[model samples]
Target: MKAFNDFADRVRKEKREHYSKPVSYCLNYILVYIYEPITLNQLANMVNLHPNYLSTLFKKEIGVSFSEYVQKAKKLMKRNNS
Candidate 1:
């Protein structure tokens, strides 16, 4: 059981690292196009992902919901006058 648990942990870590690129791309896109309207479905299409899969992967990799992350980024941009 202990060995199985360790393997599971390792797999989850690897999955997170593997998913980082798509998450990073989404983050950068949101920042660069912060002023433009965007939706999860639209982002999913842009990233060649299914909306549900992207939503789960994004929350797992980013530690927040997509909308929450976008809102926080927009707030920071506004404060910085960007």
Candidate 2:
């Protein structure tokens, strides 16, 4: 599928950043919910973290703003017809 290829290409191109301790949990959460209807504020509340802090940490590790990542994911999902 084109969407899967896009996902694979992104995975191959973008090097993941390192995080530690409890914050790493957010990384896993982000990965699982990439294409879901979620926002930084929602995720911040879910993870019990401050919005600003979450945004900073997310961008630092993920190498993109949260909204940007979500947009790309949504595009991919649409491409895949999922």
Best by TM-score: 1
Model 2 agreement with the true structure over 19-72: per-residue lDDT tens digits: 643346765676687666777888788778899988887787767887887787
lDDT of 2: 0.74
Q: Tell me the tens digit of each residue's lDDT in model 1 across 12-82.
A: 99876675777888988998899898789999998899999999999988889999988998889899995
lDDT measured at residue 45 in model 1 versus the true structure, 0 to 100: 93
Off by over 4 Å in 2: 1-36
Instruction: Quantify all predictions' global Cα lDDT against the true fold.
Output: 0.88, 0.74
Worst 10 residues of 1 by lDDT: 15-24
Candidate topping lDDT: 1
User: Candidate 2 — which pairs collide?
Assistant: none
- What's each prediction's TM-score? 0.72, 0.60
User: Which residue pairs overlap in candidate 1's backbone?
Assistant: none
